[model samples]
Target: MGQAGGGASQAQEPTGLNKLQHIRRRCTCLLPLAGWLMTCAVHAQSAPTQSDFGGAGLLQTPTARMADEGEVAFTASRTSPYTRYNFTLQPLPWLESAFRYLNIANVPYGIVPNSNSQSYKDKSIDVKVRLWPETHYLPAFSVGIRDLGGTGLFSSEYVVGNKRFGSMDASLGLAWGYMGNRGDIANPLDVLSDKFKIRPGGFSGTGGNFNTSHYFRGRPAFFGGISYQTAWQPLILKLEYEGNNYKHEPFKNNQPQRTPINVGAVYRLNRGVDLSLALERGRVAMFGFTLHTNLAESPGPTKLLDPPPPVRTQTPPTQTPQQVDWSAVSTELRSNAGIEVSKITRRGREVLVTGEQQRYFYPAKALGRTARVLDNQLGADIDWYTVVATREGMPIVATSVHRQRFDDLLDYNIDLSTFRRSVEQDTPLPQREEVLYRATPKKFDGGFSLGFSESLGGPDAFVLYQVSADYDANYHFTPNLWWSGGFSANLLNNYDKFKYDAPSNLPRVRTYVREYLTSSRITMPTFQLTTSRQLGTDLYGLAYAGMLESMYGGVGGEVLYRPMGERWAIGADVNWVKQRGFDQDFSFRQYHVATGQVTGYFNLGYKDVTLALSAGRYLAGDWGTTIDVSREFRNGVRMGAYATFTNVSAAQFGEGSFDKGIYISIPFDLMLPSSHVRSANIMWQPLLRDGGARLNKRYTLYDLTSDRDSDLFQDNLQQITE
Candidate 1:
């Protein structure tokens, strides 16, 4: 990642400038290519439909069509001996990715010797990218890989093209691997290298490796399909030619293929759901359903529970400062404007309010409402209003507004553009001024909520889940100092089925998950004391100690340098920790290790994408680098994926060659009828091993000081008027 200005420069070496220049030159050269593609891009008549394999396609074969960006879908289908559960996402306009779990009904899991337990479950990932958009005379083209970085059972590589004519969409492609088992066509790449004709076979070691060397090798076949929209608006019909004849299947459980034709129909139940049925191999019947939504542009539930912004008065105020009810103004700021007031001070013609925003996700909304409350309460003598926004005890950003200009905009005398020019934002600094009102801060806060945990794809059972009632409490000794703790009581659970514990060659820092999950009915996951400070204008610091997470108790500290208005930030953290007992109480285990990392964050200007790169020593005493990439939708939903590559060999890391996962964050306001700044996060990790694990820190300076960024306000500017 290229470093931005200010504090980010310190994290870069001298060679950074040359690399940045090279990147700029490369981007400049690609501009014309991008423009050409845009000029030729075809507009879709309707939204793309999901295929049985959980992507944009027809029946059994994929197409070159792309789904709208930010689309998320879950698909489940059962076809005779095979059952599939798939999660698919469109994070970019030209990219589609899916994670799938295929269950073989006839095959045992095979992991537990001498035991007929769960059915065989295989996990795989697929990715597709559009190479060319369809134009008036051209067809759209796409290249993709199926079952990437997994066992070679279902692996395939294909290049496909699609063209639309009236209500029909046609697609064709050449396939390899399982899909090309028919060998109807010779390998085209054999001319480039003889090795392409000699394909390696079988699963290597424990699986999960990319096995890139085997991709696009062996004999090939051809597949084509067409999808037609019927006169009935809610129905579509599909016909496809199969690529594989089913001569070979995983686990030597092949089935006879009477024919290579598949037919299917899809019925749209509603805008968000679809039901599908199909017949494949001229014998098997298939049925499935899909649930999908566009997260990028979907307007969430209306906020009926929130208070309306303070009303603007038609006439100017006439009351003097002393006659004004300052107490009432403070109360109004908290209740209506969502600001927790610390003090109200007057400096000549300006009134400065030091407070923290607790309710609204966007700072502009709070500022707009604050202006209305002050304009309705104070006299005309107060010409300016400034807010010193604080998080803990430390001030972060100071925003000032011209009182008359704001009122003019609200009253329709001036436009938003004119009023926006009169606003000023800068870093906050301490100042001595006349204090009008200093309120005492509330000290205690607590809440109760429900929690859930689950483990999937294990050999012991398909899924082991738990539901719990959780209690969390916080006691603030000062604005920056506090103690926090949480406890959970099991409401319901089937964790008794969690009987497998995979052995690790290392210190077993994380593989003890089974023991932790089944250890106790009531557990205290965290109990910690933490304090924070604004060390400098652009630097922040935090330190914590005690039971930091369910499996570890530790002392740790972090320092972050994030310059205001910059697109980048850098931070570092280190922890000295000891493993917690399986009971998740105050007891400790004998194993101990020191882990630390230096991480850099970069916000790429395209599609709200951001990248985080970290190099560190992990819990198992292994060293590695982790890369995280994420994008935030317009509606405040964020989706991201991360991967870690350690110095340990693939065999040492076991099942999954490395560690990787994906996560989604949904803002609470999207579901609740009230304004909320917090979000709920859901993460999926395929397999948890002993490598590339870091401390699950409860607090990070970047998240704590999020309000300091101007982008949050600009991105949600619509809230300014509401």
Candidate 2:
């Protein structure tokens, strides 16, 4: 089996440290597999880490076993001509996905070299799904596709099974394509179709196609491996039989195969790291390492602050609403929840506090905490505390809570049904004399940010990276009206190597990517005026004008209708813009266009899953629908996949057979809750073609007004008192 990029893995929840004693006290059937943490003498200790190759396997091939859900790993391993850096993520117990960078040291970057004979790097994708779970009598089984989408230099398909007995795990499988180049066995599915009798030579010279027609259509071979735990924990011995003879390596260079048997050893250095060494072909020596973590769980930021105003044991003294020291309450709100109070008013027995959310990710925590503040400052006579959660100074939801019941609810003393009955959620109308305190909106605010833009796997360069620093600010004229802008300067990049452009017959909508990156060190990607307002109880409206992004300048508007506490929402957006000149300096290109979309979103109600679909005209006049599916973990990590299919034919779409990519978003709050305000996102697309490109707009109302969804409150219910 071919494997690369291996290091270490450590996965523990924030409170996992306290469970070590318990884990050491008992041993179970799965104990042997996790006994790496302790010496063989103390076999009860479970190692909180997992090792992998090809995303979810031991070496070159996949196994029925899957990584723990939400586990993420990065691997870098090498043998000789082939070195790979791969990213693996497990979002579900039955699914595994990975994106890889395969470097062939023997292959030149291009026919015409820039200097020395450099290696060729290819990007590829792999996915595996379990078909059956391992039981007392049966092995776990799974089906997978490797190097299926991208340059198909190492493409193949396989079905594998895995089983664990005592201190040993064994796997066996059948493969095709690059995995079965030896042709050890005749075509197995030839009876189904004559096409299955022969395999194609190679994929289209121009890559980036989700070509499924070639799957399982070739000679098959057998591959198997067995790993055993040694007397010492953390040291496992492995032996395997390879299916491919390496007769057809990349770049047309065939490799020698001395034998089919491979022997290896894996050593655990620490909880988060592992070291491996192996003998391949009885000639090549290989070594590597891995680094991994559990995205599903992590320790909460450990910083000290005012303890959430101790959940009072007894009710405090009463006070007139006018005498409730407003300034002191404002300071408490900012210190505990990062909420900026805009206005506070009292109407008889109920008090209304309106504010903008700036810090706490859960508005429920903010809402619940404010109620506690009122409970301590006012008497029991004051029956209600209402919060008008605002976004950009506009009211989104007016949530009312019964002060007495809120305390019981937050303390986990009451059921959701009983607690929900004590609260009322509504959309507020105009008011006259109720406001007792009003905060003058800040006219200007700004901050600093850092980001990177990168592209990989082109004939010109293996990897192109651009790191930039940005300055962004927003000017508030009214609560609902504002102007925002940002300018970024490139601090480092390898754009100088971006000399060659792939052949394309379509419009140059995205072909000038290099020109824009090299044009200037500083660029104004955005400068715009925006306004938001509630059109009705469940409908919202937004309008914006000016430079929307580095690629386009436009004026746009959007309208959305999302019910108060529902799983579905629909919206529409329209824009008109001209391409920005390479200089990114106020000059526009001759190319211009108008585009828009009618979008719909649905909550799948399974493990934070959501589906979104959009149909519209694209930037290059192509009409299409883009479908996106994503799942957000409770810890704020989001993994998603998207595909856009348009009227444009495959040939016209250029290098990419169609538009598709996978993305992951990491929320900073998971690392530094007190300091985080936004999440960071990374996208990996096979190719940026013109067929399904869209203007990169800066803002959207749906994201801005998200608290309107009922699930938002349920997701964070346990954090109410924190």
Q: How displaced is residue 238 in candidate 2, in Å?
A: 2.1
Off by over 4 Å in 1: 1-45, 320-323, 412-420
Model 2 agreement with the true structure over 1-722: per-residue lDDT tens digits = 01111100111111111100111011111122123112221111232222234576666666677876776666778878788878777788788888777778887766345723446766678888999889999999999998777667788888999998888889999999887777788888898889997777765655667667778877889887887888898787888887889888776778887997778887876555667788887788878776666656643454353345436647475777788787787777666656788888888888888888776665666777787777777776688998888887667888888887877876679976788777677776666646667776668999886645556666655566666777889998888889998887889877677666544566666667777777999888678899998888788999988887677887889998988768788999999988889988788999988988888888888987888888999888889998888777776667777778889887887665677666655554554425344544445566666777766655666676666765656666555556
lDDT of 2 at 460: 54
> What's the lDDT for all of these models?
0.77, 0.70
Q: What is the lDDT of residue 305 in candidate 2?
A: 36
> RMSD per prediction, one decimal?
8.8, 8.1
| Best model per TM-score | 1
Score residue 330 of candidate 1 by CA lDDT.
92
Clashes of 1: 0
Error of 2 at 691 (Å): 2.9
